[model samples]
Target chain A: MTDETMLEEDGHSGGVVKKFLYVNRRAPYGSIYALESLEVVLIGAAFEQDVSLLFLDDGVFQLKKGQDTAMTDMKNFSPTYRALEMYDVEKLYADRESIEQRGLTEDDLIVPVEVLSRDEIKDLMAQQDVVLSF
Target chain B: MKFSVLVNEGPYQHEASDSAYHFTKAALEKGHEIFRVFFYHDGVNNGTRLATPPQDDRNITQRWSALAEQHNLDLVVCVAAAQRRGIIDADEMKRHGKDANNIAPGFRISGLGQLIEAGIQADRLITFGD
Candidate 1:
């Protein structure tokens, strides 16, 4: 895309890259929130906004490794988390307290995630232009 | 301030839809610009015209339609979510070979990109859901 094309589109649709934080607070399965949230992340990536994913509570389980769903009907979607890097969704965070409470270490997760304290999470939330919860 | 609202639950089954409606109305009352209301997940159920609640109870869907009509508000239902939940407009009903369309007036079925656009265009993006 050239500057001429950008200016043409900007005449009607003016947009600036905004910080969009998608806060996930649920387990991966038993509900559709986890899956649908991922779908939104993939779709929203097309907009080229600054995006981040924060996992707290049961949402941390979404990144849990060695997920075996062969017996159940649910698909093992943990692999998709690894693919998020391809979409430039590189910023992933988790609450340290929540992870510790669940007795899961950073190594237990499938992907590399920055662990932050509760206060740090609050500050991070304040920094976001939009905080979408699921 | 310009605001965009995201409703992610059903009309009567959850408070999310009602809360979103009231918040939008309140914002409009205070002379704020509502950029759009993007309904997702079960929230698409709020756009159905087939809902007939008890006469004494508040008509959640109608309230939204009236508010949109009054303010010329853009009430966008996520096309993917709506299709999955059986909330179809005329275009979708025709394309999918459905018997009828149940989308209420003032509500349009569109893509999820509209929600992202709302987030970009609006000064604030608020999500009212579980």
Candidate 2:
């Protein structure tokens, strides 16, 4: 293919990546879904698209400190979250209502996320190009 | 708006299913269209044909089926997860030498492409998983 044709297709709609918002609402070790959601988010991030992660309810447990999955014989992915920044996927937010309900302070979490109220979370959900919960 | 829902938790075992249900209902009530409901992981159980709940409590399986029926929504269950969990269609039941097919009528067994397509087509792709 010539450079002219390549350029024409390069600027097409298909070449434009889509933005995805992942809403995580569960504890990490309790089920396989949490890890699976992370894998999906990672895959989307790898595609060079906008990928954002929102933590709500028990999903905040994924980012909680002192996660001991060793007893369950599961891989501790608490550290993988630190790599999210390297992927340029830094739009991490947490529902303040969920954190407060669970008695978790921001210090109790390994990842630093901006806290928002329920209304704010709803607003955030509204603005997203796509929202997937896990 | 077109919406896509990802249900990754079981109806009986987790609150994710109910949450997804309500969210979908609300979305539809607001005049939004649900493009697809992708059931992955344990969410495949939502489409099981053999679940029997108590009379007093709401029949979640029926509720899901009814919701889909009312809205004319596309309910998609992932093939890999469904097969892994022993939820199979007639063809799969025969191939695996099973005695019965456990998949419900309204739900269709499909692949990850449904999810990928939903993400592409819907304005929102909300997930309900724990």
Candidate 3:
């Protein structure tokens, strides 16, 4: 790396673990936001922060099973959600309203997520040191 | 109040970048410390020097370049995001065999770890996007 790049790499938290939340609000395949956001989560997993992934609004569809992107021609990235556990990113939450409004049951989602009420989601966000939404 | 700003959109397609620029300017004017300004996704386009908008309109890329100059800001474009958008730097051009790097002044391309570090160090990590 050049000296200029090194200037930005200076100073990392030695052991202070901040609660970092990645909130996905866009659906998969509609736009690149969901896929790109997941890339951030995976890249950031190395930092070992208290990371969490919350799927709300259209983002809830990202975890739905049977996502065949062959027709859409976009890469099927839905399966990557399952591999997040391997990276030690275990905290996954889903907004209850968004799921129900879309007529999706708990079993409809591919990955297991703690269905959170509106107030619960607010409380979860309030506790986070940093919250990033897509 | 130390802040790290995240810009998630491109220069002109969305108001996110414009709002982020104004907010960053206002924050610096208020004498607040800015840890970093991260550009991700299409936000990486804000760091491209080749963007030529109309003469009358505000040149968003130059605005950020000027802001970084004035504030000595650490303006970082995510390496992964930039690569996807073809926003190559001089070093990247050599490494990737890309001709003609188009990165704007005062912006350095780096990893997402910088974003993580910003969250850890800054008082607040503010995100501007749709």
Model 2 docking category:
incorrect
Off by over 4 Å in 3: A1-12
In the range B83-106, model 3's lDDT, one tens digit per residue, is: 888998999899888878999999
Q: Which residue pairs does candidate 3 place in steric collision? A: none
Off-target runs (Cα >4 Å) in candidate 1 are A1-15
* lDDT per residue as tens, model 2, B1-130: 8889989888877888989999999999999999999898888999887888888887777887888888888998877668778788887787678998888867888765567567877766777774
The positional error of residue A103 in candidate 1, measured at the CA in angstroms, is 1.6
Report the TM-score of chain B alone for all candidates: 0.98, 0.94, 0.98
Could you arrange the candidates by lDDT from highest to lowest? 3, 1, 2
TM-score of 3: 0.93
Best by TM-score: 3
Tell me the DockQ of each model, to 2 decimals.
0.41, 0.13, 0.49
Per-residue C-alpha lDDT of model 1 across residues A5-45, encoded as one tens digit per residue: 22122122355888999999999998888987887787777
Q: Which one wins on lDDT?
A: 3
lDDT of 3 at A26: 88
